[model samples]
Target: MNKNLYIFKNKKRYRVNVRNYNQEDFEDLIDLQRKAFPPPFPPDLLWNHEQLTSHITRFSDGALCIEVDGQIAGSITSLRTNYANESHTWEQITSDGYITNHEDDGEVLYIVDICIDPDYRGLGLGKELMRAKYETVVYLGVKKLAGGSRMPGYKKVRDKLTIEAYYEKVVKGELDDPVVTFLMKSGRMPERLMKNYLEDEDSADCAVLMIWKNPFIT
Candidate 1:
């Protein structure tokens, strides 16, 4: 696929690209977290030097960034792992976002997170990032793409519904959640519901384990 992409929105064309993260992108990545996820999304959970270092050093192929007008506008970090009918927390699976658990023999690609600069949201950059992820799955010959998606929308109805019920409603298209809706529309299927998966209060500290199988794989 072409590394550079062009899009026209609101009558203005914008240059965009998705590529592997480089050493120079560190600062931009740090600031992006603040721009993408603000207050109530714990600042302490944001990426730091050490964690990013592990992403690039250990699983460089999965450490990707998207550029808008040559500035780092978004990123998706992931790792490799082998798994089955088992349960694990976000920290346990991703090594607290450092990807320290990357396994060379791992057949599954697990996404840690994807964040986009608020300024670049409407440009469909997040979809571009997912496009790259699917491509990566095919390229790596992995069984599928796996990730735990946080449900920020559940918080508003926590007093009215259980997380599982909320998740079910979303899956059945009875509700529209910013995050979960995006994932489902992107072709990811819900695998399971997890508790205390992350620290986001919006999700009530819950997450949905999701997957997209690689059709290219046997």
Candidate 2:
């Protein structure tokens, strides 16, 4: 892993830092989940101390955090694995987010978690965190960046539109899904939609399978 750190200044002039997350960041990271995922999303799904430790212990480079003025504002967690079974659910692939399935030499960098603090929106931190993930693909010599993005905004439109219609509109920018739209802007292309991909009720338990191929594939 390159251990490269990315820095910038947001509109408010707060220094933003994108770098690897350590055990000391567990508190901020956990609080971030409370703000990012809240109610309907299972609280159990949030990163626990054990899980945070597992991330760094198993693959430190796969865990990155974005800080603003030294305050953790965003996080992205990934694992290395091949996309053999498209039918696999989030729990199966990530061992319920513990990332126990981490494969050192897997072909793809599978992002299981990406969230920005609700207070930190409009800062482009999500995109920057994604850039770090893309960088991980290159630095770790992986094949691509892949993940099943949530559609938190789907629930709001479910009554007015079908799932397909919702997805289509989001892709066309006629509509916006919190996670899906953000990932799209970060250069991830939606490949397909899968049911029961996650336990997220906000997304109607559906997920958009997305990916970004590495241009410099070795």
Candidate 3:
């Protein structure tokens, strides 16, 4: 709620701006995606301005773009779904006779994507991007926030305890990530969801599905 409109850091300080996407915004959006990911998504997905607009238009509250010095530096997309009665949010888990959760007006906000240019790493851009999505979801009266995050490797071992440790001790439900430290700090992620895996040639990459219940506006 600073409303001062920018986060001032050292030399590489970055400010995040949230705005609805226009058809003209596709190229820069795709460029931002390429700069953010290791294996960037296909550019053909947003081949034209119209294609970008169509993607943005699918969100319940529309997509948001983050700009640093008048250029697109990052972006986030959120989806609102009627999961009021559905026990499981994952499409892979839902089954027949599963009383389809009816929002009856209630809805859950799913953060589909959050990305930041590599050049902007260590500047807290990813955290800001997440905060933006959280604020937006709160404004929309969503009751739960959820997402799936990819781990670097399936069986990768770390000298560190785990991402969950950090989540439990530091963040304390204020934030969450698939990395065990952050996710555990934010909230406990269900093992049932965490164990869900995909096959890879060398090793399978583990993904953790996380959920944070909104204490406010519920």
Candidate 4:
């Protein structure tokens, strides 16, 4: 995993290794996580390379980090699971509980989280991080990808209050969900899948689940 990779630069671009996290990258990642999150989680919670790579290699589907201008800019984590016979199914939008007569042993991918520095926002770094995850999932034979978000309760109040309020007032407006916008722009998600998604944290929050059927999975 010690290979060199390069990203775009203005006058001159420097080359760096785009690889998995090691012991040395912990502090850098912690800083990035703090800047990316509104109320950043404690640094001690972030696992070291040995622990993280073990989680990915064993239970998780994919874990990745990006190096921009010779520094860690963002990261993404995803896992595989099957959700066929859960009895009661919760809707993605509206947070309504429902049951469907559907069944499949489909391979699922869960996007744990993703983040980039505020200065690096809108530079397509997040998209690249997502692409990295998608590629990993596609390679790993995962049929779908899903992620959960806070409705508008403690996580929101502790984090970005303004962004949370915007979602409440606008209700699915593009101004609030850049992640959804990214998924749509990539053509990886269906517009119809946004149903049952929660608006606030009170009831039940919806997780944005995107499915990508492998062309060779059948």
Give all candidates' CA lDDT scores.
0.89, 0.85, 0.51, 0.50
Candidates, ranked, TM-score? 1, 2, 3, 4
- Which candidate model has the greater lDDT, 2 or 4? 2
The per-prediction CA RMSD against the true structure, in angstroms, equals: 1.3, 2.1, 6.7, 8.0
- The backbone clash count of each candidate, in order, is 0, 0, 13, 9
Winning model by lDDT? 1
lDDT of candidate 4 at residue 165, scale 0 to 100 = 49
Give candidate 3 misplaced runs (Cα > 4 Å): 1-4, 11-13, 40-51, 83-106, 153-192, 195-205
> Candidate 2 or 3, higher lDDT?
2
Tens-digit lDDT track of model 2 for 1-218: 32334344453466778888998899989999999888878988988999999999998988899888778899999999986337879998888888888998899899889988999888788888888888788877778988888888989988999888898899999998888988888899998888888888888888888998898974
Estimate, for each residue in 1-218, the C-alpha lDDT of model 4 and write its tens digit.
Answer: 23455556565555544455554666776677777754333344343455454434444335567777677877765445565223212332111211121122337665555667787665567666666666666767766565544333334343444443444433454343455556656545532322234433431343344545555667
Ranking by lDDT: 1, 2, 3, 4
What's model 4's TM-score? 0.60
Q: Which segments of candidate 2 are over 4 A away from where they belong?
A: 1-11
Clashing residue pairs, backbone N/CA/C < 3 A, model 1 = none
Write the number of the candidate with greater lDDT, choosing between 1 and 2. 1
lDDT score, candidate 4: 0.50
> What range of 10 consecutive residues in model 3 has the weakest lDDT sum?
94-103
